[model samples]
Target: MTCTLENHRAELASLLKPVFDSLGTQWLPVTSEQLCDRITSEDTFAVLPIPAFTNSQMDGYAVRSADLLSAAPDAPVSLPLGFTAAAGDPQLELQPGTASPVMTGAMIPAGADTVIPVEESATGTFPELVRCGHGTPSGQAAFTAPSPEGRFIRPAGVDLAAGALVAPAGTRLAPAMIAALASSGLTEIPVRRALKVALCTTGDELSNGQLAEGQIPDANSPMLAALLRRHQVEVRTIQLPDDPQGFVAAIDELQAEVDLIVTVGGISAGAYEVVRQALSPLGGNFHHVAIQPGGPQGYAQLGDATVLCFPGNPVSALLSAELFLVPLLREFNGLPEPRPGHYPLAAEASSPEHKHQVRRALIRDGQVTILDPGSHLVHDLARADALVHIPVGVTQLVAGQSIETWSMNV
Candidate 1:
């Protein structure tokens, strides 16, 4: 039976739930220093406030905001220079009516409530107390009028409070997230274990040395592997010929090793459709989805592994993976759901009468231009950054009309 796009996805999710649930929630301690792209299994709380202590946000003087209350740039207030508060200095205090030189990120002195950048002061340079003025209250520095209380002073907890929920569960930690965690003194983090998948490409042309005879090389394996790797999924790729026994044997060998098996080719209506023949007897659900380029699709439960099959054409296989597999894998890996974006068509485009046409598109500056309409040009797909999806029954999409799109780079 034919299935709609959502029907197939829902079915796949239901069929794969048992397998994914069996894997359970396993977490590994990942070193925070190298945890980029790791998915968090649980919400992360800030153990301590980011910054931990109040600090200066500029290289200037740390003084009580009151000292420069009435000061002006033309007629500046002069005050005695106190000690320098460099970064990492511990427990220093600003003297009353005095200005203490502070480097950026230096802890704000106990009595200081404001930081005036050196450039805003009469003396643009950080003063050397010994050489500039020697000693006494007579040694003074000019400052701009204090803008307000807490000026240029990054208060403790300004960024994140202690015990605050910094990252919700399912967050994929990037550089900024790592920095925030590090600032809260996190040395290691609990990240979800990577999902293992087997990528199978079936075609007699690819299995043997037929490239010299004008046969297509195996491009789906590398492309699919890279796509899976981008989301931190471990992939094992295998290339097999158009033989039912070989396909069954390949599936048997990999079912126990991977969480999912994705096969490229041999699922269409053609005579040499080895994958369809091999899996259909074992109760694989194969159908023509209401989508172009990737109409022929199949899914099966083989022992412990879940299998997803795509059509053999290079563009078709990639489109299938981008539309169906990527989002599924991302959801299982605790990443955010793929967002469907809309952009105006840069030029006129046409779609198939009954099927939802997904055309390779180049989206730029809020406009999407179809790269290959009603064609399976792999080069055009390469130039595309997104796929323009025209809904069924709408054959014509005029220039400047909004079209729904899925980003390929994601």
Candidate 2:
């Protein structure tokens, strides 16, 4: 009997519950330098405020806003230079009626609440040297304009404050997050443990090399392996014979090592389906799903491991992974949920009457265009950046009609 695609997905998820639950608190420490692409397991806080102190945002003079309140284009104010401050210079108080030259990122001196850019002064450039030895420069710097208080000053804690929540739990660490963590004085991160998966391909007619007249090369195992490994899931590929005993042995060997077992092929109604024949007694519920190119799907519990079964066709196996297995694995690892989008079809397409059909598509300029070589043909899938979903009961999709699409980028 055929099950709705959603029901089948939920059933498969239920079978893998134990593995998914184990990942909630399972975490490991990753240093900031190695945090890229890792999924955070807990919220991280800033130890210190970003910038830590008010600083100058421009290479100019630090002055009190009151000093330049009356300064204008026709009547500019002139003040004796108090000192010159480059980035990292020790903080010094600004003497009254005097201005200090401060470079970008230099701490704003006490008693100063504004910055006058060097170009806005009569000097038209930064001072070559600053005398902080109680003697002022011979010529005074004229501020030709007036700016509001706090202008060009980066106040303390403006970007981030101490103890601020920076990265919340379950965030995938990217370059920006890593930089934020580092700037917040964090050196290490707690990240979810990488998932481990076992890949097994079953068939008597499968080969890795040049095929004899009736033999087909095994494409499912390698494709699934790459897809899983790309997401940091550890994958071990197992070759299973058409013999039921061999298939059982292979699964038994990998039972203790992997969190989940994904098998491609031999679960359909055909007589030579070795996976179903061997594991049927173990409670594997082989059934068809209301989805085209990936209708035949099943899952079963063997001892402590969960085995997810996909159909023999390359497109079906890969599409099953993208549509069902990968999403579950991503959720199990604390990754954000996938958000499929809807786009207008660039051309007309047909859908199966009862099953949800997925066409490999390219989304360009807000429209989705289907690719050729169809479902059984595997090579053209590489060029597709997305999968356009045509739901059950929808017979045809006219050009310019909008349909849901799943991105294959991740």
- Against the true structure, what is each candidate's TM-score? 0.78, 0.79
Backbone clashes for every candidate come to 0, 0
- Residues 91-120, model 2: lDDT tens digits: 979988889889999999999999988887
> What clash pairs does model 1 have?
none
For candidate 1, write residues 79-158 as lDDT tens digits.
89887777887757778998888888888888988888888888677555431234542367897676577889999898
Q: List the global CA lDDT of all models.
A: 0.80, 0.82
Candidate 1 C-alpha error for residue 313, in Å: 1.1
Candidate 1 residue spans exceeding 4 A from truth: 18-38, 63-81, 93-99, 111-125, 129-151, 172-175, 207-214, 330-354, 361-376, 390-410
